[model samples]
Target: MKPSSFLSLARFGLKTILFRKTDPILGTIIVTDRCNLKCRHCSVNNITSVLYPYAQIRDEMHKLYDMGVRILFFCGGETFLWRDGDRNLRDLVTEAKDMGFLIVNVVTNGTFPIDLPEADLILLSLDGARERHDLVRGPTFDVIMENVQNATADNICFYMAINRLNKDAVREVCILARETKNVRAVSFNFHTPYPDTRELALSKEEKKACCAVIADMMKEGAPVFNLKSAFPYLIENSFPTPCRQCVVMENGRLSVCGRCIDVPGLCAECGYFFVAEYTLLFRGKPKVVFEMLRTYLKYV
Candidate 1:
């Protein structure tokens, strides 16, 4: 992170700690639910297949900015597929930076060309190694890797969702992140069991084993984005749910945390490591603060 960006995050962290604020400092706006791929673990795609108009997205950005959100993420059902008239995802990213967002990120499956160098972070989904990732996310691993290599920017982060299919390959992903050009780091999240995807959720034992692998990777100096200090919390699922430190906006409706909050039991089963990390940090966990400083300094 740049000095100014780090300072902004520090300011927000201090204010949140001192004032006991529950308001969100980071916000995600789903530009569109229209996706090109139908992964087995995903439940949010292909419902509407409508690209939200540019004007509506702009309005949503302003609304989030008004709500004191400085960090912005543009999510999808594949952000590359999002378009309104002649505007593309890059236009929205530029607009967010102009509107004073400290960090602008885009989360994608990495199936398309990653030419958006304007984005501070391009979170490319890479579930596991070639065969396993292809099994879950379809036969696009080679293409995604090619796109990653072809990408002009160096801000890509490998976002892996560990579940039944890819749990065994977590170490392989760490190696891929280390060897791949333009990939800055790798972040892991357990598969949250939404309504129909319960079978994909890892058991507590499985989650612990995966965390052990990640911990070893961290010790070996792999560019993994997860905090090693919070592994215990993640294994026990003891962290608070429905983290109030972040919010998500889809269409015009805004929900605390991400869209998972609206799902019935998903919040109770949330496996997003960042949610747990942020929740613990807000509650003033000394170890978590140190972990965040170390991981984020390396990431940015």
Candidate 2:
């Protein structure tokens, strides 16, 4: 297997195994509902709540950290769009770091320029190349590229959700990510058919084809983040994941989402690929471990 940080973690996994028995190691915190763009597949436009202040978010982080959460991800409609009177996303990252969190993650839509707040990982939600991407996002690929080009740091990467619209261009996106000036690596995910947004989800056949391409790219040592063994779980939908690591905090409150909490019968339809990836890690899949380590090394 390729040498990676996760290999080192695997060496210490025996020691850390005791911790997983007691508490969640990672969690997602939606610091704000504020967003600048209204992507058709997102629920950001439906949100009518105001952005919460930094103090409240900081308090939430403290509580989670006290609960043994080692990794914190700042997700949002667009986390970079979040702001208080003077503080910004970078401030949030700095605070999370000060609280002794192992890593801080951000998921953004690549609209605004991210100037401050270095994160352990910044997953930029990209659709596809200009023409296809313009259909999902606005005709602002130039601006997005500008932001990405200017965001020439070691703590950021790209995540392109494979959908019917962009499925055919998956390879192109992957190549672009590796060849792009500022992009570090590309992670792939399938679109979730949320309440009002089902059109973006890929078909079973399409997903399989995309996975085949991804697996090939991975075999070729392309810098793409994918769980080697767990990728099949995405194709067949037979993967088992213990989502004990995450407790989503949305709009200043705990929300497990109806899909994960109320009607778990529909959890099989969930689009978060990280779930299967984590399961593969717990299973000690070497390639999966390598992928996870590669991710940490790139971001951390």
Which candidate number maximizes TM-score?
Answer: 1
- Prediction 1 TM-score vs. true: 0.98
Clashes of each: 0, 1
Off by over 4 Å in 2: 1-22, 44-46, 255-264, 283-287
Please give, for residues 111-130, the per-residue lDDT of candidate 1 as tens digits: 99989998988999999888
Q: Candidate 1: misplaced stretches above 4 Å?
A: none
What is the Cα-based lDDT of residue 190 in candidate 1?
A: 95
Q: What C-alpha lDDT, on a 0 to 100 scale, does residue 160 get in candidate 1?
A: 95
Compared with the true structure, model 2 gives a TM-score of 0.87
Every candidate's lDDT? 0.92, 0.71
> Which ten contiguous residues of candidate 1 have the minimum total lDDT?
260-269
